[model samples]
Target: MSRIAKRFAETRASGRAALIPYVTAGDPAPDVTVPLLHDLVAAGADLLELGVPFSDPMADGPVIQLACERSLAHGTRLRDVLAMVREFRQTDSETPVVLMGYLNPVERMGAEVFASAAAEAGVDGVLMVDLPPEESDDLTGLLERAGIDPIFLVAPTTADARLSHVAAAARGFIYYVSLKGVTGAQSLDPAALGARLGAIRAITELPLGVGFGIRDAATAGAVARVADAVVVGSAIVRLAEQYPDAPERFRAAAAELAREMRTAMDAARADAAPAAV
Candidate 1:
C-alpha cells in the first residue's frame, strides 16, 4: 500500500481521523516549501498534500485561487514541485506526500510518463481535482502500476452512481468534499457531511477524508468525529499568503493551527471511547 493508504489504515485502526494539511508547493518560495512541510508533519499532520499551482484552479475559492496566482507568479511548475519533493525525499520518505493539482500539467506530461516521474520523485499519491473518473481510468491504472494511489473526490451533492464510481476508482482514500461550494468557503456541517458520507461508506471500505472549508480546531474537531481524515486546505495556503515575505512566521502560525486541531480531535476521540467496566 502507498504511505497515504497505510497512514489512513493505521489511523482508522486506532479509531482516529488523520490530519491532512494542504500547502501550495511554491507559494512563498521553493526554498521554504520543504522546511514548512517538515514543520507541518511535526505539528501533527499525518499527511501533506502539496498543490501544484495552475493558471486556473476552478474548484478553489478566492483564498486558494489567490495562492495559485502567487505561486505561479513565483514561477512554480509541476517540474519544480516534483524537484522539491525529490529533494524532500532525501531526508524523509515515510511522511506521505500527495501532490494535488489539476489535470492540465499531468496531461501535458502524458499519463504513464507523469506517473513514472512522480514515482521517481517520491510522490505517494495524487488528487487531481479536475480529472473525471470516466476519463481517469488510464491514468489511475498507470499510477497503480507505479505503486502510487489515485485519490478521487466525492462531494456532498454527488449522486449515488457517481459516488459508487468514485469508490470504485479511488485507491488511497476518498476525498469527501464536505460542502457544496468551492474550496475555502465556510459553510461546513459535520452532521450533514456524516449523512452524505454514510452512503459513500457503503459503496467502499476505503477511508473517507472530508475537506473544503475546514479552517480551525473547532471545525476540524467537529469533522474528525465522523470522517476518517479531516483535510485542511485553504487555511494552510492562506498562511503562506498571510506572510508572503516571512515563510518562517507563516509556518509557525500554521504549526500552531495544526497542533490545536490535532489536540482537539484527539481529546474528542478520547472522550468518545467507551468507559471500561
Candidate 2:
C-alpha cells in the first residue's frame, strides 16, 4: 500500500481519524517550506497537503488567494514546490505529500513531464482542484503509472451518480468540501456532515476526509466522529499570512493549531469508544 493508504489503515485500526494539515509551499518563503512541513508532522499530522501556488486559484478564499500571491511574488513555480518536496523527503520518507493546486502549472510543464518529476520528488499524490475526473484520464493514468495517486474533491452538492465516478477515479482518499461556499467562508454542521458522509460511505469504502469550514479543535473533533480524516487548509494559511516576516512564528502557530486539532480528534474517538463489558 502507498504511504497514504498505510497511514489511513493504521489510523483506522487504532480507531482514530487522521489529522491532515494543509499549507502553501512558498507562502512566506521557499526556504521555510521544508521546516514547516516537518513541524506539522511532529505536531501529529498524519498526512500533508502542500498547496502549489498558482496565478489564479479560483476555488480558494481570500486567505489562500493571498497566500498564492505571496508565493508567486517570490517566483514559487511548480518545479520549486517539487524541489521542496524532494528536500523534505531527504529526512522523512513516511509522510505522504499531496500537491494541491489548479491544472495551469501542471499543464504548463506538460502532464507526463510533471508526473515523472513529481514522482522523483517524492510526491505521493496530486489534487488538482480544477481537474474533473471526466477530463483527468490522461493525467490520472500518467500519475498512476508513476506510482502517485490522484486525489479528487467531492462537494456537498455532488449527486450519488457523480460520487461513484469520483470514487472509482480516486485512489488515496476523497476530500469532501464540507461547506457550500469557498474555503473558510462558513461553518460546518456536524450532524448534517455526518449524514452526507453516510451517503458517501455507502458509495465507496475509501477513506473520507472532511475539509473547509473547520477552524478550531472543537469543530475538528466533531467532524472526526464521522470522517476517516480531518483536513484543515485556510486556517494554517492564515497563520503564514499573519506572520509574513516571522517564519518561526508561522511555523509555531501552524504546529499549535495542528496539535490542538489532533488532540481533539483523538479525544472524540475515545469518548465514542464502547465501554468494556
Candidate 3:
C-alpha cells in the first residue's frame, strides 16, 4: 500500500485521525527545511506537505504569500526543494511527503521530467492548487507510473460532478477546503465542508483531508470527528518564518504544534474506538 493509505489504515486501527502538516521548502533556506521535516516526524506528523514557493500563489493568503516570497528570495527552486526531499528521505522513509506548489514551475520543468525527479527524491505526492482535474492526465499518468499520488483540492463551492472528477484524478486523498477563500483565511465552517466531504466519500474510498483556517488542537480534533486526516499549514509555516536560521527551532515550533494536534486527535478518536496499537 501507499504510505498515506497505510498510515491512515494504521490510524483507523489505532482509533485516530492522521496529522498532516505543511511547510515551505527553502523558506528561510533549504538548510532549515530538511531538519525541520525530521522534527515534524519525530513529533508525530503522519504526513508532511512541503510547499514550493511560487511567484503567484493564488490559493494562498498573505501569510503563505509572504512565505513563498521569502523562499523565492532565498533562491529556492523546485529542483532545490526536490533535493531537500531526497536528503530527508535518507532517514525518514516511512512518512509520506507531498510537494505542494503551483503549475508554472512544474510546467517549466516538464511533466515527465518533474515526475521522475520527484520519484527519485522520494516524494509520494504532489498537490498543485491551480491545476484543474480536467487538465491532469499527463501528470497523473506519470505520477501513477512512479507510484506517486496526485492530490487535488475541492472547495465548499465545488459542484458534485466535479467532485467525482477530482476524486478520480486524486490519489493520496482529496483536500477538502473548509472555506471558500485561500489558505489562512479566517472564515471556516465545518457544516458545508461536511456535506462536501460526504459527497466525496460517496464517490471515493480514499481518505479525505480537511485544511484551511485550522489553527490548533481543538480545531484539528473537531475536524478529526469526520475527516480521515487533518491538514494544518499556515500556522505551522508561520512559526518557521520566525526561526529561519535555526532549523531545529523551526522544526520545534511546527513539531510542537503537530504534537498537540496529534494528541488531541488521538484523544478524540478514542471516543470512537479502542486504544492505540
- Give lDDT tens digits, candidate 1, residues 1-277: 6788788878877877899999988887878889888888898999889999998999989988888888888898898999999988898888899999999998998888899999999999999999979989889999999989999988867888778877888888889888888998987877878787787878899988889989889999988878888899888877878888997899899999999999988876777667411
Q: Can you rank all candidates by lDDT, best first? A: 2, 1, 3
Model 2 Cα displacement at 156 (Å)?
1.0
Among all candidates shown, the one with the greatest lDDT: 2
Name the lDDT value of residue 188 in candidate 2.
85
Q: After superposition, how far is residue 242 of candidate 1 from its true place, in Å?
A: 1.4
| Per-residue lDDT of model 2, residues 77-193, tens digit only | 999999999999999999999999999999999999999999999999999999999999999999999999999999988988898999999999999999988887778899999
lDDT of each: 0.87, 0.94, 0.86
Show where candidate 3 strays beyond 4 Å: 244-247, 274-277
lDDT of 3 by residue, 157-250 (tens): 8888888878888888888888878888785666666666787788999888999999888888778877889999998978866876776777
Task: Looking at model 2, report the run of 10 residues with the lowest lDDT sum.
Answer: 268-277
**Candidate 3 lDDT score at position 193:** 67
> In candidate 1, how many Å is residue 6 off?
1.6
Error of 3 at 227 (Å): 0.6
Q: Once superposed on the true structure, which residue ranges of model 1 sit more than 4 Å away at CA?
A: 275-277
